[model samples]
Target chain A: MDDLRGGCTLELGSMTSALKAQKILGTAAIPATVVKTSASGGGRGCRYGLRFSCSQMANVRMILANENIRVREAEWKDGS
Target chain B: MEGRELTYLDNAATTFPKPRRVIERMNDLMQNSGGNPGRSSHVLAIKASETVFECREELSDFFGAAGPEQVCFSLNATSSLNFCIKGLLHRGDHVLISDMEHNAVLRPVYRLWRDGVIDYSVFPTFVLEDDGRKTKIIHGILSKLRRNTRMIICSGASNLCSMTMPLAEIGELCRREGILFVVDGAQCAGHIPISLEEMKIDALCIPSHKGLLGPQGCGAAILGKGVMPKTLIEGGNGINSLEADTSGELPERYEAGTLPTPAIAGLCEGVRTVRALGIERIAEHERELFRRALIGLSQIEGVKVYCPHHEGSVLLFNKDGIDSEELCLALSERGICTRGGYHCSALGHKTLGTTNGGALRVSFGVYNSSYDVDKLCEALREI
Candidate 1:
């Protein structure tokens, strides 16, 4: 639901890593929606990423760091 | 599970009577999340990706891989073995394999040698009783080591008989020599306790349908921390779609094309079932069944059981004056499912001196019991 409400998305480079991040976040009671991340030019080649609420960015960062999941990039999208 | 009441003893080829949960999970996956894994961000695709990754995670934990990404899916152990063998070895590299290797390992290495990409040697395995046996095997391998030896590949357990390679010892040797250690875990993954890191195994090739008790058409190459082989077969694995080359990742680099989500789902449940039953308990059960079949067959007149000293999940033997194929056919007529001829193991049959007629292999699984052994013995007596 948080993903539907305007939040931050963290690109994790691959589906395996995105799923891994999702699982780790779930254990921490954070909801995440796995999304296909568009490349820098927004073309066909896509990586996997996680979409979550912007307010949980701090907690997500801390959890991901502790879990050693390096976020390739992060961008915020308005949930309009 | 949905077939006739035949007594299946060819567990070495592929384990039958998969656990109920494995079937259930596979069915559930097909019914619910049937989509290509890692292909899209849609709900079904995401779920499919999750299912595949979950299985990867399960297999990684089961085999003691560095992480889930290290587990790469393939058609079976042969494909994984090919991927590892063809990808890892370079020109002028010398590979050492044991005498009990199945065709999966033997063929690729043979082809590589014939293609002039590498040189290879076959080291013999000797069982000298308890503590001294490992040393003897190691000594045999040490004598065959070449200056360019790049890898040592062996069966975790022989598919022909109960003979098991001293993998930890060989792995230790490879680690010390800075040579890669790879194991064809066709007969040992679920039957034996293996820690890839602990054993310093660079790669372990396994089949989902063998000791794993999952459905066929799926397997994995569980790579160690630093063992990254070149891509044998490549296309797209939902990553780096723009690049002409494959991904520079752990499994995605290897697992090209479509992922077998349902089979992987079955495998996840299968591994869970194995853990539930306890690997030690299951292995002991098979060994006990093996002991029973061994004793029963030995007592029968004109029956010759090979490797009577080795206790394991598989036993090989032949009846006197009977062609192996004929005996196997007779057993089949009696509703006993077993393998005859060379079992696709030219090296193993030669090593065991059964090349002339090969032998009958009766492999035990968790679902099998002493009753099956008794039935096989009684049938042998009748035949």
Candidate 2:
């Protein structure tokens, strides 16, 4: 929670976006679990593979593009 | 659109922005002279037949053939090649072809080879430093001929890199060997001046859509002297429908179907358009475009161009660290249309050392300009 505080937005390109996300999550590998939340407009259910709560992925894309980041998009694996 | 950038460099495959006169003539013929040619003595039928003859005449004069009647209309270059190779060949006959030949010449030869219809060998063009050295290179093909050699098929100019084959010497060799000499003029028919008599070519298969600026589904083969082939396809010749048999003449003997009258009319207009521009001027314009692309691509860092100092039909190259397909996608996104792949000449890729996949090919045409080449180079640099 301390590492995720301050909303310290760094214009990390797609390359650094994944690294930073992994560091903030404190996981060398993404957890293979589904988490449910009640904040979603739709019925939120368990999701996997770094599941976005709402529009975090879209926000990251906008931030990257706005800052002219030259990063390739991260590959997302399917959750069983 | 003037300020906007858009370039199309894939002319060897097919041409766009077709000649206005060709389109007009096609419309005029369809509206005014719509009838089955030679099927009736009615005015419309006679007019349609006349239109067909006029197109044959146009092709005849374009290629310096003996007469207009010698030109046989077909679907395209592939069908024309089939008519020549399959009709004139048999089991155990030997065929001498070129390495730069497109699939039209290759598939039929291969089919024949697999079926034991013929024995074949392909002579690669010798990369010479000087243009004058082409004569000696031609003699090399002649030296490999066996006694039972039935024909020699070579392209007028390579579809890959615009390189003109030494057809005249090959024609002379075939003439001396008592073998048929066929020239696949798919890339050079209307863009370059050709003479059947002067070159002693036995048959020439050409595409009306490429250099001639005609409709896509039309082509012709200018049959040279002593080129009577056995029937590969049998159908109505329109002239002798009641006979229930194919004719044993030149054009009528080979063209067996309801002829493409409208397309032929359009093709005639295409030939007329090319004739008015002058083939020499057309060739020169395309050559200048090639020269610009070669120079520009060579100047770009990490780009390896593939013209090899020869003024050929296609400009092939690849930028370092980029896949050919990826480069093509990038170019297409930039409105710079090009062909990237093996170009249907898989054998050529192995020889050119691009068999891993292939290289990006930018072929030129009379409609293309130096600015197109510049835009392509600029976009490649950006990538």
Q: Candidate 2, residues B1-383: lDDT per residue as tens digits?
A: 33235698888898876888999999998887798664543567656766887787778877878766578889998888898899888788999887777788889999999998789998767543446647765766867788889999978877777677777888888788788989998887877778999999989998889988899898987888667778778886543334556753456667766788999998898888888898788878877888888889888999987755777457788888888988998999889889888888765666577888688888887778888989999999899
Tens digits of per-residue lDDT for model 1, B40-89: 87778988988888898999998888889889999999999999999999
Candidate 1 vs. true structure, TM-score: 0.95
The candidate maximizing TM-score is 1
- lDDT, residue B263, candidate 2: 92
* Cα-lDDT of candidate 1: 0.87
Query: What TM-score would every model get versus the actual structure?
Result: 0.95, 0.79
lDDT of 2: 0.72
Error of 2 at A28 (Å): 96
